[model samples]
Target: MGAAPFPAGILIAAVVFHATVVLSSFPATFHLERGITANYKLKLSKLKERDRVRHGRMLQSSGVGVVDFPVQGTFDPFLVGLYYTRLQLGTPPRDFYVQIDTGSDVLWVSCGSCNGCPVNSGLHIPLNFFDPGSSPTASLISCSDQRCSLGLQSSDSVCSAQNNLCGYNFQYGDGSGTSGYYVSDLLHFDTVLGGSVMNNSSAPIVFGCSALQTGDLTKSDRAVDGIFGFGQQDMSVVSQLASQGISPRAFSHCLKGDDSGGGILVLGEIVEPNIVYTPLVPSQPHYNLNMQSISVNGQTLAIDPSVFGTSSSQGTIIDSGTTLAYLAEAAYDPFISAITSIVSPSVRPYLSKGNHCYLISSRVVLRCGALAFRKFRVKG
Candidate 1:
């Protein structure tokens, strides 16, 4: 599958919550940064590499406690390989910049004793570590803990018999990995009240304190404290908070893909009059969507529905960690044919590094289906 730029609009993912709450609404919102100088090819390759690895396996309360942290990184995965946010952890909280990834479970940051963890980042952000010894509130998650059992069930963490510590080792498709033990500590943020009012708050949450990093994670380029997983597993921050009744069982985000590159992520649902709801493929490890068909310029492409079916090797996954949209070969062929047929007359279409590229004049408006591209080279 080849990569294509994400469609222009707000990207929202709202998972259904089984329980209902009757408290005052607290909407925790934050901003995200997009890397403007990241290597596009490198980002695209990483996305594909991640997809290959993914086929193998797979917020708040208060007042109804909604906690908001400042986010950094871009909405466009092509422009920036990742989007991250700063989390305040431990007592007398210290800032830790962690990648915001929806693909994997468990929130982890480098620990004081971490080895192979980059001390600097090419992203131009300061990297910090979480020291359990320094935080009086920080506690090691015992192997016998219920959370440890859950983590083991989800392939998120391991239980050591000798020390009885709950630890984790997560491997990425790009060969990057991080390993650490779980720690219960204070996670600080701003609690939003009535949407506008803000109050300081802290919650005890279980997160990984990374002791080792490997592969791309060890590189100074694009390095951060660690990753903040927004996955559906029980060990994710979302599930931890929901279990404690501090927040609802749902979360949402609106990503901006413009040059300014900022977005809003909330711990609760966004009630918009025009919002549409879609059912998620149930019991899947990843956020798999049941996509039935593809449409180009109001004309439906003649692709088989089963091409988008869920299986060990096939399924439609909505992964924010990925930089571009990937279509199965069956769907990709017709999709590219449709788009090229529409704009071929106005531009020179060719193959560049396995992607379909189009060189067009500044005045040419490249339109495919409902999407319009202008003033730049188009690649897919």
Candidate 2:
């Protein structure tokens, strides 16, 4: 049938090939700053690339992670009000919601009935973020600006009677989400190089203006506006940094809660302490090498055929968007048993037929060789 089992010799060869590919790729797991804007073409291509990794019997989910997004500024005490994974463009900062999605690129927000768009809402939707006089010399994204096309696609906007573009839409994520647009006259922040409020007066911050709607929507921010798309896309906030000569491929994030104080996000390199970091090799530009084989508790079980089938070769990806490790059915038993033993036995694991490979206890410890997955607990 399927190419006649590849003959014994060929099958052995395939096994060797499998090991070689992963093993060889292991050494390539570090970020290289190869000059900003220079490697952007390379980054964009990988995001759009179609070939997916298939391992043994499992096909890795075709999800891309956009881990770098600006911490939302909330009208309420920011550190307290900001609970959503994503931020909307139009809703009040304290009430916005966004998905920490790794599946698609582009960060978008929902702007209900927006028009005359610009920054966040793109072009079609409109949002009001300006003084009619437009005395702010900092608003640089004009109808004839090249950045609009470079970051955002283009607008189908015609002039309103006042001869102004009206408002704009900032579309970052996919159809799964939307963000209206607003123009931050400038993007300002405390300098990383020097401790001063550095201002990019000419730079316009275009965001996905969104509204927090109902039904399975992110629960943290019901009164929020929209999400911040951190996925890899040409129009992402990370991608917009090309002007400052920053690399889009090299980025990181740390989400801190009420108790832990906080964490830091390193865009180029990780300079933090005490974090057991896993070095990943970027296969091309934006994509990293996935793992195909796993050994738990010193025992190797037959990988689930459901993962890829006996003949496939894609591997497991370490996703920041996903909070848990996804294992095939073959790998589930030992995976759970090992975790249960280390974590509180009160924790319970779940298997949802064809749905989840296994719903791991909310937080649990997972030990693999020298690497340990801590903060392990179970949610009901």
Best candidate, lDDT-wise? 1
- Model 1: per-residue Cα lDDT over 291-339, one tens digit each: 9998888999999887878887668777766555667777788888898
Q: Looking at candidate 1, what is the lDDT of residue 352?
A: 50
TM-score of predicted structure 2:
0.44
Q: List model 2 lDDT by residue over 188-229, tens digit each.
A: 322232111222222345544333333323333222334444
The CA lDDT of each predicted structure is: 0.72, 0.36
Tell me the spans in candidate 2 whose CA falls farther than 4 Å from its real position.
Answer: 1-104, 110-176, 179-185, 194-202, 211-215, 218-224, 246-249, 255-261, 271-287, 292-315, 337-380
Off by over 4 Å in 1: 1-63, 194-198, 361-380
